[model samples]
Target: MQRGGRVDGATLANLAGRDGGSGWGLKAVRDVHQGHRLITLPSGCHLTYGANDDPRLLALIDKVPSELWGAKLALQLIAQRLQGGESQFASYIAELPKGFPGIPMFFPRTALDMIDYPPCSQQVKKRCKWLYEFSTDVLAKLPGSPEDPFGGVAVDINALGWALAAVSSRAFRTRGPTHPAAMLPLIDMANHTFSPNAEVLPLEGGGGAVGLFARRAIAEGEPLLLSYGKLSNDFLFMDYGFIVEDNPYDTVQLRFDVNLLQAGALVSNVSDALGAPLDLAPRTWQLQLLAELGLVGPAANPELNIGGGGPGAEVLDGRLLAAARVMVARAESEVAGRGVERLCAVDRPLGRDNELAALRTVGGVLAFALSNFVTTLEQDKALLVGQAVAVPQPGGAGERQLQPPASEDEMLAVRFRLEKKKILSRALQRVGALSQAAAGNAELKQTAGSAAAKKGSKPSPATSKGFGSKKP
Candidate 1:
């Protein structure tokens, strides 16, 4: 606290036996009121790429890609770590975790494979590979000259990995987007929670001091928490080395492929008159409409999302919903002149039959995703509780005995996939309900038409309305 830093009613301590335990955390020493300032550190305590003033260090930093800001800061951290007692922040550097066992980059092959979700798994591998190459190919080859930043110290993959993990998990970009990210001393000790009790803010007058304030009243011994972001499990696990239970921000991603939609439509019983599989090949108008929505053409984004948190969150991305509806539409009259916004609204069903087809098609997509997982949601839950579950071997081989996760990494992987499965299952249930309701409504309309014919009255034809319709 001597370096122009202040701590009020809070103390750093080892947070054992708490949620995701065995980490250092800041805890309230006494009752603190809401909006109270709890901690403050002057600009000198902020560690950033610009903190190291050595000409050689700054020159070397310029070699790193601008987008790899984490790596650039990691280089600064490594230089300080090498300085040891000579460094101004030696005490803080020493307190930094020697190894990050929780990060997926450090997980064993078996534990990594347990993640199962390709999007996260592939990213983990890519980062790991880049670290290896950058360490050996770039840092290791630096010339031992006057410009040598590390003073000829051989930086290996292990050292670089440690530095990278430290920066990724703790650094914050408080000084706007244009400024490099900074690591705040003592301020970074706060653990993360979606519902944070405290928050980090800039001190008044903008003198470059960072302050932490209570967002709500804090009881004595309450752990001070800060929200990392509204991130999914993939980000939380990959970057922070932990996952929140029932995270509302979590989403399952799928590529927007017409073939997948075709399979979904077929499985949901959408077919042609000759009993052939439903054709999802977009016609000229449908393609134009999709292109207008940024789902087709060279610049189109194929990524689609589902299962977001909170009551107001959409279960399906609007673009994905619109595409599904447009693809299932067999006639131009069904969707002609309808604004893209109108087609995307969940409340605005095209027709009873059309709505059922669209809902069921999306359901088929989710079902296929769920089938890719080795264990069901129930099985995953059972495994988490220490129950042994049997899983099928590859290639239709006989089932093999699977035991409960033996390591924290493996357990996290299981938890991650489990949440994803829950999201898919929940989405499926919602669409299933919609499909059933639409079918029932269609049946009722058919019954009503039969009654009107028996009464010797011709039933009026239903007029399909598009956006901006006006009555005669």
Candidate 2:
């Protein structure tokens, strides 16, 4: 690795080895200022797609389909590792971790079933299943048996998983390079942090090296960090075998069945302003509403806030508000074709009550979904304080030993849940208030109507009629 910029006394080593280094990491010998170059990986030293000159590897790659291109690269890496000193990637391969810890592929069935989040667990299962399929269908078709190093055996699912994880965590999508994605040597050693102190920039001009420059000042002996972009915990765990505690960018997805919503619309008294009930099926109606708001399918995940204008604002999200409007309009029998702008207007011509009612319904739904996941903060705090699980003793002993403190995974899980819980709880309370305001307004109107009816029914002292009746 060559120093790309004015890097002063920086070296690559197992920075995390003391704490159980997962692999190689970079460290600073002296204090490095912001913008100081840490390392540069020369072009020839890196591995990119379609760069392997080996005829056998290229032939194998040609046989593999484009969709499974990543798998082909993984197989190539394994083949080179088997080649030892003769392989071009010997040094880089040696530095990589033996196996990626916490990758779902390596997880046992029992462990897989233990994942708290259903989405994450489902994803893990899907990935593992796909990998197994590729191994059987694709690898089995290749020449030679399991004993052959350069042939089929090199594509073992387990070995390929290691390569997959390494490439995923380390590779960069470079523009000026021959391959779509390339793996840099020293540049890949930097660990990920949400807030990074350095950035990996592709060197401008036609040169091959990519520069790792300090984004900010780094104290001596501090490990350099890079951002892997903002990612949620579920994705992070699935892809990187780890989760960030209380990630600000994290959110719990709430999925709704369009069919169910449509079914409700059919039987419900809710209708548009014309007083006609929804003509379409509940699912179709939901789609129409979402289509109006441009939230068809995957676009449905809206950033929820306690109160929202936009993402960081105090007002609620516009998309959510629009959805609430549609629900209210349908319930109140409001007119069709009213867009989001009209619905969200402060002085909307009509359907004000409908908006409030919608807010209540939507808020209730969100709260219920949020409450189902994660333990209460109090419960989490108690667990963190001191929770123990009994484990069977060795040699078939009857007694069970209590292990102090929860596992790291459990701790991280609770912490992540606690953060999400806070957001959900706050938003629930706001929605509740909005609902109550709507209810209170309806009650006030009912009381006023009653008083007016009573006054109208009362006799006008029988004065005018008495004039004619008394005279007769």
Maximum-lDDT candidate: 1
lDDT for residue 456 in candidate 2, whole number 0-100: 17
TM-score, model 2 to reference: 0.70
lDDT of 2 by residue, 105-126 (tens): 5666544543444555556666
Top model by TM-score, which number? 1
For model 2, state the Cα shift of residue 85 in Å: 1.2
Q: Candidate 2, which segments miss by more than 4 Å at Cα?
A: 2-8, 13-24, 51-72, 145-154, 176-179, 258-287, 295-320, 330-352, 374-381, 388-423, 429-472
Q: Residue 131 lDDT in model 1?
A: 89
Q: Model 1, range 199-308, lDDT digits (tens) per residue?
A: 99999878688899999999999898899878887778887788777778887777676666765665676654344556676678888888877878999877777766
Runs off by more than 4 Å, candidate 1: 17-22, 309-312, 440-472
**Per-prediction TM-score:** 0.89, 0.70
Worst 10 residues of 1 by lDDT: 463-472
Question: lDDT of each model, Cα atoms only?
Answer: 0.77, 0.55
